[model samples]
Target: MRLAVIADVHGNLIALEAVLADIARFSPDLMVNLGDLVSGPFDPAGSAQAQMALGCPTLAGNHERGLTMNGANGLDALARPLLSPDQLGWIAALPATLTLLDGAVFACHGSPAGGDEEYLLEDMSTGRPRLDTEAAIRARLAGSGGAEMVLCGHSHVARMASIGGVLVLNPGSVGMPGYRAALPVPHVVEAGTPHARYALLERGPGGWSAQFHAVPYDVETAARQAERHGRPAIAHSVRTGWMPPA
Candidate 1:
């Protein structure tokens, strides 16, 4: 089966729309949203509604937890306005994780034991972040029996790594990518035009192979929307996938 895995859609309706349009071309068996459906420049409600309308299976994201927990740490002022009671309710109702039929487990934000707000950056030092180890990740999958793959997001950094024969995939952030900055950090890809990022997991005869896809959208339009909503920084970052130097 062909499954489209999407994550970190931080309320950029334009980007999400573009990605959905692109997904239509592939016609996968299922569209799975890894979460962070809202909490960005655009309407979180709109994004959540759109995903629900598409009948896609969605997991709870960190932003969703923020909304549910009333701790809007990462959200900007513009994102605050777009959130309504109904939108918050939708986010609160989302499940933290899901297991697919093909032994593929999907977590909206991170590993099962780590919670939804963990950042799984590959370049971190040995014990800097207190993140999960490879053995811990394998232990998380032990309950799944035949499950060989784990899909997760929330770091906004795209990567595919194997831990003891099990594959862990992070599709990256679709609306706002984090690792595409112009910094000297490892795993930092050169900043290019902001585009929608996603993954296509195809089950081959041998095993599952995942292909990462980036689709360019109308960045100017999205930027304009953000600016109009009073989020200039986000708009600027969306136009060029680089966060301004702090």
Candidate 2:
């Protein structure tokens, strides 16, 4: 069966819409959101509402945690006001981890080893970066009998890695990307391309294949919306995938 996995939308409705449209073309049997649905450039409320409308399986992202925790450590100030009392209550109700398909594990923001705060980067060359080792990552995924696949997102980078035959997939950032460092000055540039990023996982007799897909969308309009929202940083980030130093 074909399953679509999306992550780190960051409240960019344009990107999310584009990605969903693309996913529709694939005719996926099921759709799952890794997390970070809202709390960025576009409207968080809209993003959350849209996700609910999609009726897809979703996990709680770090930003959602922030909303639930009332502007916790991991959340940025820009996302604070987006959460009304109702939104906050809804976010708080979500679980940090979820077990899908009877055992397939999924985390909205990070791994079980560190909740929503962990960063599962591709490399751990420096003797492991706390929650960076494969074994440690797998052990965390091995909750109550283990899981065949562990899906997560938080770094805004796209990657697929196998640890002890278990697949760890991060579908990248749907609204904001930081994967291709060599792309340009703006880490996530807005070239007026109507493209959104996501991943499709197909499980069949030969095993599973993860495909990264980028769907084009109206980025210019999205940027304008970001500007109107009084979010210069988000506008700039959407235009050029780079986040300025605080």
Candidate 3:
């Protein structure tokens, strides 16, 4: 089975379109979105519509909870008003995690039990995002229900690892590439390039393997949309894939 995974599409339709076009080149058997779908400065409603048209299995990210379940997030607040009832309902119906290929593949926006807030592969205690230890990663996967391959997003960093023969993958972000996260600790996550990211996973006799893709789009156009929406920081991030200086 060949699966194309996209995540953290924080409403940048431009980036999402670019990534989708690139994914078409491979003609994947399945495509799934890992959420954070419509909570950003650009085209939240349109983004929702586009994903709905695809009719793929989509998992909800933390932002989806904020928008529909009353979690406090500024981006959610910004996007909530723009989405119509159908769009809102579609997001609200998404599962936080999904199991596919009859349990061979597990897909979630974050860690299995930690829901949408925890970082399964990242250790943020050091005031930045870094790969966590193998033991720690295993502990996080203890609740994954024994899926052979785990797919997660939210760190917005494309990375892959194999622990105890279990493959773990993060397909990176499809929309915003970087952001300064605040809460458990203040730090920034940057991809260091203005490109839309995704991953293609294929299963063979050997096992499952993944390939990451970064597709270029009209960065200036995306940035200008952010600017017109009064989000200069987002504009800068879209153009350069790095957050503006605080």
Q: Write down the lDDT of every candidate, Cα atoms only.
A: 0.71, 0.68, 0.90
Model 2, position 148, has a per-residue lDDT of: 66
**Cα-based TM-score, every candidate:** 0.83, 0.80, 0.97
- Judged by whole-model lDDT over C-alpha atoms, candidate 2 comes out at 0.68
Q: Can you write out model 3's per-residue Cα lDDT over 110-180, one digit (the tens) per residue? A: 89868888888998887668999999998888777879999899999999989898999999999999888
Candidate 2 Cα outliers beyond 4 Å, as residue runs: 71-77, 83-85, 123-145, 178-195, 243-246
**Which prediction has more favorable TM-score, 2 or 3?**
3
How high a TM-score does candidate 3 get? 0.97
- Candidate with best TM-score: 3
- Candidate 3 at residue 156, lDDT? 93
Cα lDDT tens digits for candidate 2, 87-157: 66666677777777777555546766767756554333432222356766666554423666778887666
Candidate 3 or 2, higher lDDT: 3
| Candidate 1 vs candidate 3, TM-score winner | 3
Candidate 1, residues 37-140, lDDT tens digits: the string is 87776666677678777777888876677766644654733455566777666667889888786545544466665567545434344322233567655665
Any runs in candidate 1 off by more than 4 Å, and if so which? 71-81, 121-146, 179-192
